[model samples]
Target chain A: MFKAIITVKLRPSILDPEGKAIEHALQSLDYTALSCVRIGKRIELQVDLDDRAAAEAAVDEACRKLLANTVMEDYTFELQKA
Target chain B: MSKVKFGVVVFPGSNCDHDAYHAVKHVLGSQAEFLWHKEGDIGGADVIILPGGFSYGDYLRCGAISRFSPIMKEVVSHAQRGGHVIGICNGFQILSESGLLPGALLRNQSLNFVCRHVHLRVENATTAFTNQYASGQVIEIPVAHGEGNFYTDLDTLAEIEDNGLVAFRYAERDGTITDEANPNGSLNNIAGIINREGNVLGMMPHPERVVEQLLGSDDGIGVFASLINAISGDVTIPGVAVLP
Candidate 1:
């Protein structure tokens, strides 16, 4: 089996409002000096396919089609044998 | 298209499809049909409406999965062919994701599901949906959503503003457009916008909810009337009085 890990994040140009609120809370607790903060999500997918190439292609298709909204976010994935 | 045929799209999780259907059928005095998302046909609908709901359980993003519904291809073509389309709340997000309309709707700034009647200023009255209201008229519409914050890049925002594509903006009851009045923190307090062709409209407000005066206000009737007017190019509603 092949396992793919995908990381999705809002584009840097876009404001992460939720992340910003967290950053402010962190500052209140004395975790300053961090100039910026962003938030994202990760998804892991396992398929029965043994070929790394095909597994990666399928994951990419998933990201482009439904896993990630390219309008305001970007996605990257890594695949490995399961 | 001699008659105004309204099509209300229904995704698996769509809860407002019936509200939209009732508003079109009874309030606007027109024939309304439900278009299933899995179906590829629009049943020759002249006006298509994407009603609001937690489609696909709001997976990945609001309206993200629903935009890929087989019905969307027909929607895009219909819009391209000068057909009128309205997306309310979740439907608004789908239109943005489908590229039928510009910009995107994000999580509400307050991180809460805002449900209330908000004053909206008609930014442009020339479109088929806003002709019933005078330019800059303030109309009360209910917005109920957790992810209604509208966002867009600066250039695209400027272009829409320059072209008067903004159909509505959050405003005060007295018609003042201010940042304080923005319920969702949408860019420029945008509540509704039309596509460049002026045929497609995507708004976060729910005009379908307040069609009757018994429900509190009859202000929303104008929106439906504007749409019926667009379809028939006349104000003669079959069984309903043409509200003045």
Candidate 2:
């Protein structure tokens, strides 16, 4: 079995409104040194595959097809044997 | 002339499906039906309306998981066949996710769910969906959503403008495009856009919700009338008359 860890984030060019709100909140709390803050999601999945390469391929496909919207977001994944 | 058949796709979380159906069946006096999301066929609809609301509970992202619904395959094929398709609000997000539309909707710059009436200037009235409205006309439509800020690559944005694909732009009551008139900070104040082929439109406004004067404004009736006229070639725009 393999476990795949995926991270999805809005592209740098796209504006992150929620992140901006968080940044404002942090500033209010006196954490004023931080210049920027962007938010994203981390998804973990378990794949019952024999080979690491096969598991990686499956995870990549899942990300491309569903987990990530390539139009405004980017995704990266790492697979480890379980 | 035959009545234009409208199929309102009912995704699991779609709240506007009934509104769309009512607008077509009652307000517009046309044939309308509900198409469940799991069905693989379009049921011979001349126009397919992907109504608003969070589909699949907006999992992953707005309209991402719902794009994989079985009905979406048929919707894509229908769009490829040059049939008419309109995605309103969340439906717009689904169309972008399914690659039917050019851009994606992002969270509003204010990070708040905005719900109110806004003016939209008709940018391209020559298309199948805007023929009933005069060019440069400002119409009032209600928009309700958080993820309505439209975004695209700069190259695609240039192409969309060069091709005149923008159908409507957020504007002042007098039809001036300005940042203050923009409800969601969409690029170029875009409120609606048509596909290159001019048959598919994805917009953030709920035209179906305002088709009757009783609801607030009948400005949205033009959109349905335009579609009906495009399909059946004979629809008279409803108007106020001094009761004989």
Candidate 3:
């Protein structure tokens, strides 16, 4: 078995509306030191695969098929043997 | 009468519901109704649209809070049964958040709310939504949003292309959708995509804004026309005709 941890995030250039709203809220609260903020998702998966290569392939398939949308989100994974 | 009924979902912060409703009723001359977010049902419409806007004040992420609305549950069930669903801008974000569509809408690469007229290359004409457009045809549409950046892994990107799920791509004046013309730095210059069933489409551009000549261009008429035609059995997938 193997465990896969996936980190998904938006590209760097796109506007982060949630982040901006939070920044605005922080400013309203008199918190002026913070400059920027971005939000992302993290997912973990456990698959009964034998090899690292197979586990990686499964993670990739899951991300493409449903976990991550290629158009708006980027995802990377780290695999470890169980 | 085409007998196709369209419904536009109106969430608390949805700003483009009226525009989309008019696009369907006036431009397509069909029966279109407004659906509130709190409603339990979608009124059994043929096509359900999630209009653009800052739904739920874009809190907890663009569409995060809106995803849990009473209406979204029905929308998800409807979509699973192969109902036609289209999400534009913030609607697209809601779709992602509700898991009706894969992937997430992130901050734009430029870190600004981009509002401009952009050229898009039709990548897949086989879907119900893109049947009116010719594969590879370039059309101009207006986009206004902040978190429109599209992201996915390289393998998934390739899969989307291979499966013909990519509906439209951002392009330049030369009709080439390349990295340079990519406004939000989306992977593969993708501007729109369809779900695996090919029944749901999510795009950032506002087709409703370009449907009338008074809006500076009627390029978006074909898109709306295509959807109407799809229901009326006037058009078919994989047809051989170039779109302007």
Candidate 4:
């Protein structure tokens, strides 16, 4: 089995209002020198496949089709034998 | 002219389907029916409405899962054929996800769910959906959503403006576009936009909720009236060459 860790994040050009709100909370709590705080989602799933190449393609397809919306978000994934 | 048929697609968790159906059938005096999401055909409807709601509980992202719904296939085909399609709020998000419209709706700048009536200036009144209203007319409509901040690349924004695809813009009562009047921080104060062909429109406001005078303001009736007029050949839409 292969395990994939996918991270989806809003693109740098897109505004992250939730992250901005959290940043304000951090600043209020005296977290000074904070440049920025952009939040994203991390999805971990296991793929039941034999070859690493096949598993890579499957995970990539999942990200492109369902896990991430390429219009406003970017996604990256790492695969490893489980 | 044959009576227009409006199809309101009811996706899982769509709360505004009834409102849309009522707006067309009772308020506008048209034939209206609900089209289940699992259905692949458009049910011979002239206008398709992707009503507002938290479809699929807005999992992953707003309108993300619903875009893959079976009915969306027909919806896309219908739009490609130059049939009229309007998506309001969550419907707008779905249209964006389905590639029927451009840009994505991000989280509101305030990080809160905004629900209230706002002024909208008719930016382009020549489209099939806005032909009843004069260009620059300000109409009052209610917007209810948490993710309505419209975002797109600078190049695409310029292209949308250059193509005159913007249908409505947030404005003041007297029709002044201002930052203070923008409810969701939509790019360029955009509240609604149409496809390049002008048959598909995705907007973040609920025009159906205000279709009757008893519902506070009847300004929204123009939206329905415009569509009925266009479909009945009472109004001519320029630049759209939909071969029947």
Candidate 5:
């Protein structure tokens, strides 16, 4: 078995309205030190693959298929034997 | 001959209804009107459009709340019957949320509100909305949104491509289609897509903004024109002649 960690984020050019709203809310609350805040999703998967290559392939396929949207986000995964 | 009546859905916060209306009316010279979000029927309109803007204040996610609105119920039914539906920006989010389209629009990776013009390639011009453009044609349109990331499963992505549902792709800085030019990081640089029936279209860019030459380039007019041609039974674009 192997474990995989997947991180997904939007591309730099696309706007993040949720983050802006949070920034405004923070300023209204007088938390001025917060310069920036970006939000993303992290997913971890455990698979029963025997080989590292197979595990990596599964992770990549997962990211490409659902975990990440190539249009607005990028995903990177790290695998470790369980 | 009866004029093709088009209706643009107006949600509470929709700021692009007028833009969409004008694009259909002034640019395509079609009869277009605005339909309130609460309206149950789309007035037998041949084409229905969901314009961009923050709906329900982006509550419960960008389009999650709007998906349940009364107008959407009708829109869903209409689209299921093979009526043409075009969702732009926030409309795209709403379509995905309503399950009329695949994938979801998540927050941008940078957590910024990106607003700019982007070049896109006409990857599949065979849909009712994209029939006026040539395959591989590059056009520029304005993009302004926070959550425009498109996501789907691997098999679904391959299936969409294999079925020729991918309508548009991002163009690189060199004006060529490539993965690197993908602005939103969408899978396969997918900028737009249509339903299996070739009637529904969802895209992030505002083609309405580019329909008039006075606004800049008129590349977007072709999208509007394509629909006009589709309903008129005069679609003649060689690239869009066959379903991919």
Candidate 6:
């Protein structure tokens, strides 16, 4: 078994409204050192496939087709043996 | 000429399907039918509308999941054949995700769900969906959405402008495009746009809700009228070579 962990976030050029709000809250809490904060989503899935090569391709396809909007967002995934 | 047929697509979570259907069947006095999202055909409809609402519960993204549904394949094929397709609000997001239109709708700049009426300028009145209004005419339309901010790359922005594909721009009552008048901070204050072929239109405003005078503003009827005119071929349509 393998566990696929994926993270999706808006591109740096695109505005991140939620991230900006978080940045403001952090600053109010006296965490002025942080800047350019970005908000993203994390998805984890456990697959029964035993082959690593086939798992990579399937994870990538899932991210591109539904998990993320490539126009303004970027995604990355990592596979770990379960 | 045979009556121009209209189809309103009904995705799983689409709540505005009836509004679009009513606009065509009642207000415009045309035949309209609901096309299920699971089906792969749009029948003989000349114009297909992807109505608003949280399709697929906005699960992955506003339109990410709905684009993969079986019906979208048919919608794409229909557009490829030069059939008219319009996406409003959530529908607009779906069109963008489905690659029927360029640009993606991002979260509102203010991080709020804005619901109100705003003035819009008919930027290009030559397409099948905007021909009823004169170019630069200011019209009132209502917008309701949290993620209506339209974003595109610099290259795509220049391409759309060069192609005259911008269909509607938020503007003042006198038809002056201004930043303050923009409802969602959409790039270039764009409220709506069309594909290069002009058969596909995606806008963040709800035109169907304003199709009747009793609904407060009838400026939206012009959009439906334009579709009817283009499909009937009673006039020389400048775009969409689907006329046979």
Interface RMSD of each: 1.5, 0.9, 6.4, 1.0, 7.6, 0.9
Clashing pairs in 2: none
Model 4: per-residue Cα lDDT over A2-69, one tens digit each = 88999999998887878888899999999988858989999999999989999999999999888998
Runs with alpha carbons beyond 4 Å of true place in candidate 3? A1-82, B234-244
Candidate rank order under DockQ: 2, 6, 4, 1, 3, 5
Q: Which candidate tops DockQ?
A: 2
The residue-by-residue lDDT of candidate 1 on B1-244, one tens digit each, is 2268999999989998999998878766788899999999999898999999999999889998899899999999999999999999999999998888888888888888999899999899888998888888888989999999989888999999999999999999999988888998899999999988899999999988878876777677677789877768777644332336
Whole-model Cα lDDT of every candidate shown, in order:
0.87, 0.90, 0.82, 0.90, 0.80, 0.89
Give candidate 2 regions above 4 Å deviation: B240-244
Clash count, predicted structure 6: 0
Alpha carbon lDDT at B117, candidate 3:
92
| Candidate 1 wrong stretches, greater than 4 Å | A30-35, A47-58, B237-244
- Looking at model 2, residue B128 earns an lDDT score of 84
Residue A27 shift from truth in candidate 6, angstroms: 1.0
Question: Which rank order by TM-score, best down to worst?
Answer: 2, 6, 4, 1, 3, 5
Clashing pairs in 4: none
Off by over 4 Å in 6: B234-244
Q: Which of 2 and 6 is the better model by DockQ? A: 2
Query: Compared to the true structure, candidate 3 yields what TM-score?
Result: 0.74
Cα error, candidate 1, residue B40 (Å):
2.3
lDDT of 5 by residue, B95-118 (tens): 887778887776554556779998
Model 5, chain B: what is the TM-score? 0.92
lDDT of 3 by residue, B10-129 (tens): 999999999898878876677899998899999979899999999988874788778878998999998999889999999988887777776766678777899999999988887888
lDDT of 2: 0.90
